[model samples]
Target: MSERHPRILVIAEAAHPEWVSVPLVGWSLAQALRDVADVHLVTQIRNRDAILRAGLVEGRDFTAIDSEALARPMWKLAETLRMGQGKGWTIVQAVSALSYPYFERLVWQRFGPEIARGDYDIVHRITPLSPTAASFLAGKCARAGVPFVLGPLNGGVPWPQGFDDIRRAEREYLAPLRAAYKLLPGRGATLHNAAAILAGSRHTGSELPASARHKVFWLPENGIDPARFNRVAAPGDGPLRACFVGRLVPYKGPDMLLEAAAPLLRDGRMVLDIVGDGPMMPGLRAQADGPGSGVTFHGWQPHEAVQDILSRAHLFAFPSIREFGGGAVLEAMALGVVPLIVDYAGPGELVDDSVGIKVPLGTREAITTRFAAELARLAKDPGALAPMAQAARDRVTQHYHWTRKAEKIARVYDWVLKGRPEPKPDL
Candidate 1:
């Protein structure tokens, strides 16, 4: 390895050069390290056009692997079946079963030999935190004498501010999986293969095995491209425009937002603009058209359009209870829109007293009550919302920029290559 620069490999299951924040993480890392080292990004490529549009220069510091080519036909059929099984199926079984294996065979196998041949200094594995893929790639890196880092290791349920509510949700969703995950072969492999682990949140960092906790590092949830989400002051005139962007899933709490808006509509307070589409779209649309609901479902818009919508929005309502990192929240914050996030996992880290309101998570009634109170307060006090919006923009500009995130990640790669420990941040 060169004394000045180190070769790095980034492996992820998601298709790169896309709108998704996961792929953007890999892309940003590659861009950051291009000047000092050889960076090869190995990821699934769903849309070649998107990859090209991303300005990825092949054979020069970056290369992409298409995971679809390595996918088994039976796997696709199984995934189709699983997706058809609805939300519960997608959450419980399909996510780990169908998606994990695809990464193992296609992503791992396709990129492993190339990584080995390159004599990489470090290997960074991105999210979903598949023990299978982590094990396979970690093994490959280990055999090649390269240090392996697995992370952002997301997928944990949100942590409610109330200890009882958080404990209850953990018992229902995470407790059962712990026993099963311990028995998986990949779990053992992951422990043995990885030299270090990175977590996006304190909650996820705590979830790491006792053996891996020593090497665990915590980074902010998401990085934002400031150009995309430019700051805009809310107009103090007509009805306020509130927007919710993301998949229309139950976990995302779209229904809860709809419910919160229902009371507001009865009093003629504001209008709700719902962007993105999924299985819950029909139900969301039904609620919008139904009496006492003031929601407008815009269906799925292009990535570029999301920025435009956020620019016009007065507030960003994110009620998700199971996010590891709130990427959309960061985008909104960068755009100078105040975020109303739940006091759970991802958004919890992003929203503070200065930036936005964080409602405590609880039973349906508790959540609804908090949302109603906060929404009403924001709607009534126009002056209060302005400072929070400015704080959000200032916070993003100072700490959450993509360039800063990439620099930190590159430092980790350097430390691993030199067989040195990560330095504790001077808080």
Candidate 2:
């Protein structure tokens, strides 16, 4: 079995294709891994129906562990705190940290015998993407001599200075407290016991304990399904068509985008397509309607409609200040749309001069100034768009596609099994 496709038990606390963000990541990643490994996905009972709808036999392809009795109270509290937006997401994770172990314990209770019998080559915990959460099965895998893998775990990027106002608006007061997570029970042991660890960003990698740093490899959490983000034959030759796709919020910087792009919008030099709705929408609409404004507010477009908009556009100007998983950015890139994002956090790490444009992190006024200048430069010279757009497509095809990511992680599994310390997977 070791010589063939390595058998894997993939543990995902949140996984369902119908779900977005981390849950969608869990679904996409687990399915992609099956292309290279013999995988039996294990997820929370909440995802059971969706998984079945996607056509997998229960007990054979996947197993749903039921622990709602232990997790319901915390979940309910988090939902109440959520108040219908992203503010509650952090609270959900905080509550989930306490409940995750019970679910993992149930996984071990049911699958422990098979692991001990060497029925599977490895056990990997793929979600609860936060490093703050503790893993329950690392020690059990060690005792059974089955290698354990943790992460692409992400989070804990310090809020960039000068964004205090935005930080407050974002309800991220708990971000600084994340350093305290290192002291969480079993975190150190979880890091120490894992055969290989994949960090989703540079900060996440840097946050790992010194002892475990050597085995840690860098891999971002975002991966594009080519089927969903298909490439276009030829981009439109119309007005420098640009779009911003994300929630309308201060941290996402849609307001900043509007401020910068206003000059180009005047006199019909460019047309801005705003594809999402948020608290900032009313304010953004007012701003976009002002002098020299050629912006269209296509408030809250559906998933497929977003792709259609990108397919016809030349540039995707998303100037988000603190995006962790720039899935939208990657989706735009996969469709040959040139991305313009800030140079900090995930988008900063993902896009370079080679792929798309990067505006350095700074005060809002300064970023708006530089961001507008870059857009103006590109608008003035349309020739630069094609090459950068092509480069963006190539970068995602080479590095960020789902199946490519799956193959790279399969190599990590091989690397862990060989017990080497010098070379990490070049993800």
Candidate 3:
């Protein structure tokens, strides 16, 4: 008798061919496990052209659920106005009217039926806890007698201790909103329903309940395809070209980068290339376009373009303090761009003394000073950059490869099904 390969179902809002890291991780896992397991992916919606280009066998192995049928009228209204015109009265009104019904009808209604029909050994519900999606999927998976896995890989971000401090400091202002959102039906139920949880980093793993902690797995959110991130000798160029690729958001710290680059601009030691778009773009542009603005914001580019940009750059600047998985950091590192990360949760786990610089976390001045110093040092000695860049590439090639990540995930499925003990790696 032959051993049966476990059948796994990955449920997420996004899926392959999309440029986002979460979807790309799902795509990579599905492709890696196709030869071994019967893998099926169910996502809300995606670009057909991108999925096709990813070379996934659609319908045969990968499938997407159309929630358009279950979508409420108010949901369309919210999306149409760009989520309440991006803020203020419109945002509050739109969220109040659309948030609940949107989750209950569009997400849960479609996700529940899919879970009931699919005989999956393990159901990985990505990022459903934020809303009511996880709770709904948990109930459906329970009915189907399958284990449910929760985490950023499936879509739950692990908040760090520093975040807790921030929450505590802002609790007076934020508690009411948090309480109101928690009051929504199905919030606590989701956390209670999950069978296992996975975090993208150690900091994230710390957020899980004591009971869920044992089940939690720490894996990077995305893996690199080595062929794509290969290292080439540095050009030993003029001013070091530093790249920052991601959504320009307050939490991402693009503003911090701009502030840091201000002094560097005066000295002409570093040039900043900002690639991405978000609510903070206008303000970031204002800061970068000023008299001493050395930063160049390139709105947004396609995923491939970002990769090409990383390959040509000398370093990657990622100052995000709220991120759970710094996919862009890993992507840049794989392409031989030395990553300068804040010594916070996500990036701290990916970078160390050997691979890249981990700056101490602080407000604008502290962060900017640390980053500027590192940039200056690297710019003066280009030879020092190659070793760290090579180490970064090697780290991804050896430990964070998609095949290895998928295999570990597959083992977790086996453990959930057969009641096997967890595999312990060498200490």
Candidate 4:
């Protein structure tokens, strides 16, 4: 509400410019916020070099906290217990919850006095995007009479029914006990003391206590950098070019997507480009090895290269069953590649009839059948997809770009600073 830009201390422990998923989300969002506010990012020391390389001056634009004293060991322990990489994400988050407090304590020790003296207009924790990771800083900020904003917190989408096998395959054994995070120390204070909450999904919103619902704003955590994903899709005149970019793991449903596109692949009416590596790679390769399969395995691309390959495709068919925040799907849309995703979780919420298509959630066989049918129809008349493809691009440009996300967040900052006025319509 002030004439000057608001001062924001953005905390993102996992933020790294070169990483993907939550780390990338944290980095992108924190960087984007600089356009809207005077942002000083506080992140884990591990990301210090990358942040510096990205041109932010240490001790001025950002502060790197060395919490690896506890964080590193806990992470290794989590890796051992998780069985392998790309599995047991819940286990990783569970362990992260244990070590994250140390990072916050160091943050408080370094900045408490400045906060108490009102050096920053807002203290926003952008990462530990998981709702399970509670913040003690919230209560501390409250005591100091400074507003602390939490989230766009996202995660904890229940494993859909009939996907128990896929759940087990992903090593998500701790999923059932995910609710126990509600009892974690500081969980209540984190909810009660926060000035505003940005729930990344309806599921994450429901997880918050009813008393805190008044401050909840629905905002998905995933966003795309238009500069990187600026290329437009160049759909060809041959077979319909479709891509699937994510881990080849079961929950992401690479196998299901392969089976679904089998008929089109076998008939030379479609081509599949799979980008990413995971534990399920060998099996997925075998599934697509037959003659006339029209499948190319381009595993684990650099973040920049993904758009180059994706922009050449006509569709992004993602069958992920339990995605918390479908960043990959958003990337596809940003490239003007119309997405065909399972109507569940994050991607389902992102796509609607005007921009992209959604297939109903069901057993593997049912999903495959529906996807096959949709692909067949699209292949029959590829020209019909042009409208939807353009719409997808327009939507991402207007609302899902990193700059747009930052502007929306600025609105939240204004609402909180203006004494939580009635009918905060922008949110």
TM-scores of the models, in the order given: 0.83, 0.95, 0.78, 0.97
Better of 1 and 2 by TM-score: 2
Residue 203 in candidate 1, Cα distance off native in Å: 2.3
Candidate 4, residues 1-427, lDDT tens digits: the string is: 7588899999999899899889999999999999999999999999999999999999999999998889889999999999987889999999999889999999999999999999999999999999999898999999999999999899999999999888888889999889999988889989999999999987889889989988888889999997778899997788799999998788888888888888888888899999999888988889998545799999999988999889889999998888998898899888889999999989998999999999999988898899889999989877788899999999999989999989888888988999544334235
Highest lDDT, which number?
Answer: 4
Least accurate 10 contiguous residues by lDDT in model 4: 418-427
Measured with C-alpha atoms, the lDDT of residue 139 in candidate 4 is 94
RMSD of 4: 1.5
Stretches off by above 4 angstroms in model 3 are 45-59, 70-118, 127-133, 153-176, 179-189, 226-235, 278-297, 424-427
Error of 4 at 315 (Å): 0.7
Cα lDDT tens digits, model 1, 67-152, are 55444454556545444432332233333544455665665565667667866778877644433233566777788777888876
RMSD (Å) per prediction: 4.4, 2.0, 5.1, 1.5
Candidate 3 C-alpha lDDT tens digits along 1-427: 9988877676655556455655666566556666567777666554445766767667765565555554445455655544323222223332433443344345445546666776567777553223323346676676677778765432223333344543333222332243244355664566667676656666545544576656666666677766555555253567877888887766678887878767676678777888989778888878777645667677788766777666768788888775556778888877778888998766777889898889887765677788878877777866668888899888877777777776776666666677676743210
Ranking by lDDT: 4, 2, 1, 3
CA deviation > 4 Å runs, candidate 4: 290-292, 420-426
Residue range 148-262, candidate 2, lDDT tens digits? 9998898777778889887777676677676788889999889988988989888788888889987898889989988877756255565678888989988889889888988
- How big is the positional error of residue 84 in model 1, measured in Å on the Cα after superposition? 3.0
